[model samples]
Target: DVRECLARAGLLLEGAPVLYLSGYKGGQVNPAKGDFVFNCSAIYELMPTDVRLCQPAIFSGKVLSALGSIIAGIGRPMTDAMGTCGKAGQSVPSSGGGNMFLVIDENDEITIGGV
Candidate 1:
């Protein structure tokens, strides 16, 4: 499995199919001819921990965007987070797999938290 391959390479990060801000020019570009790609030396990692109050929303960039929506959206350029100055889009270990917590307010708004 890719996870095992990564683990053997001393990479402990989780989550497969990590989003590629740039499909071709990007460093982690995967060729269509290959069945899988190993990223033992992936420079970017997922953010440490993130809590989403709303469902079906992705909070990767500055703004919150809907997930699996047909709306056309624009994204910012990816950066390295572990450089001399930390930048966004540079991967870090995800908090974990699954929702961390959920709360229902009196106003009926639902809140979700996850790493």
Candidate 2:
């Protein structure tokens, strides 16, 4: 699991801090162009017990598809239904999915889909 990997890598500290578990209902991606946009929602967990809401933000970056491949190399891959997706001139059922864990040292830098 990615969590275990993070722990082994010395990324998961004793406090555990805040962890964001995110899911997106719909999105668009262009593999050739290395671009993506998602309508995402997330759960914010503060260590042992406290749970809080997080604001959604746009995720834009280069090589998103490549990012997925990199994540799979280190952790487990997973897919689940978020809802529906539409792109170009076609509408179809689509889901947003990814690996189990990614550890970021800076909390302020974290961005999720929807609050």
Candidate 3:
């Protein structure tokens, strides 16, 4: 998730002639302990077959899953932190940094810009 967001903001693929960001964060956790921190990257190139669309639904499930795992790790505190336990589980306390970008290729020219 961090890497994907970074790639979108043009922070992760500066030297590459072409780069794609894809997929979601995958990691392990222990309820007795805590969640796992990961360093990752995901890319999806803008191809004729795909419009390079970044849909919210594309990562929604994964986000929910990860959030669920985070909530589960906290156990009883989650019930209080979230106040509910549904399919998506509860929210956890978190903070992070990221960027958003819009990359455009015009006539073989590539322009990397922030979103």
Candidate 4:
């Protein structure tokens, strides 16, 4: 179902990725509050295909649900995709996480541009 969704959206890749980058984040955090290190991130994942094919507003929302189903089917805890937080020109220690190694073809919902 996920593959079908991506293919319909014209995002199914036919070759290996040209690049995959991450491990860096920069976003504003409040010192008065928890100063969460989220809402922003720097990730560049490029595949060997036409980048212009991404459908910004395709109908049907089955892609995300399908991906979630895959994660649930794994029956294993996911690792946290952690990062840093900064506020008042000072970096603060924080804690949070996300699942990794999810297998759902090209699920865009899980790849939103945010930390």
Candidate 5:
């Protein structure tokens, strides 16, 4: 899927460098209560794509990072990460939902990848 994703995005460029971060992101936010906390589990790697040898790799960064690096020279931050459940942890049942963004340098360690 990540390969297909990159292939679709046309980011399999030779001589182009890339940074990838894969992981889990979870936390709680309560604006009204003035409380906000979250976590980022970042898996980071930077490399060049061979296109021929590029496997799915399952890399995710919305192509924002790749595109930014390739086109604008600004690698977008990423996490492809998921979040914890519920608003203010109010629900009785445990579930998963919400959105969180995590950023890491190209070489930062701490990843969540591989299917």
Candidate 6:
């Protein structure tokens, strides 16, 4: 079912990825302006093809939310993100996490924070 969804979005690779990751480990956010900076990682497997693509990508919370909504509308299950927060020499555990989706369509574009 997940593969089908990816296929509809033009994200299904010719071969199955050896690995797939979703969610962030740590990040910062500005509640006043609803802005955030996060460190996220996703590793995909391009087995048999022998080609690997890696790059840094940034996406706004709005775009991420939209994608999550789209996935939910299609009945795909997503895992909740988890991380720990530290501030003022204190460490705190956090439970909130964001839904993640991989968009493979070349036409799928997301705008990050103001340019």
The most accurate candidate by TM-score is 2
Which is better, 1 or 3, measured by TM-score? 3
RMSD of 6: 6.8
Summarize candidate 3's per-residue lDDT along 1-115 as a digit string, tens digits. 4344444545445344333434435433344543333322444444322334333212222333344332111112222222322236654554332223223232212212221
- For candidate 5, the lDDT comes to 0.38
- TM-scores of all candidate predictions against the true structure: 0.15, 0.45, 0.21, 0.26, 0.30, 0.41
Q: Write the per-residue lDDT of candidate 1 for residues 1-115, one digit (tens) a residue.
A: 3233334443334443222111212122123432222222122222223212222221221111112221222233333333231138555442212222111111212111121
Backbone clash count, each prediction separately: 6, 1, 6, 1, 2, 2
Summarize candidate 5's per-residue lDDT along 1-91 as a digit string, tens digits.
3443444555535565444434425544454643433343543333344322222233333333333333321234444435444657565
TM-score, structure 6 vs. true? 0.41
* lDDT tens per residue, model 6, 1-115: 4456555655555755523333455666555655556544644444444535444344345334434434333334465646667788776776643334444322233233222
Candidate 1 vs 6: which has more TM-score: 6
The TM-score of predicted model 4 comes to 0.26
Output the better candidate (1/6) by lDDT. 6
List where candidate 4 sits over 4 angstroms from the true fold: 1-12, 15-21, 29-45, 48-93, 101-115
Identify the runs in model 1 with alpha carbons over 4 angstroms from their true place: 13-115
Better of 1 and 5 by lDDT: 5
TM-score-based ranking: 2, 6, 5, 4, 3, 1
Ranking by lDDT: 2, 6, 4, 5, 3, 1
Instruction: Estimate the lDDT of model 3.
Output: 0.33
- The models' CA-based lDDT, in order, is 0.25, 0.53, 0.33, 0.38, 0.38, 0.46
Q: Give lDDT: candidate 2, residue 2.
A: 37
Candidate achieving higher TM-score, 2 or 5: 2
Which segments of model 5 are wrong by more than 4 Å? 1-4, 12-18, 30-38, 50-89, 92-115
The best candidate by lDDT is 2
Candidate 4's residue-wise lDDT over 3-45, tens digit each?
Answer: 4434454554677432222344444433354222323223334
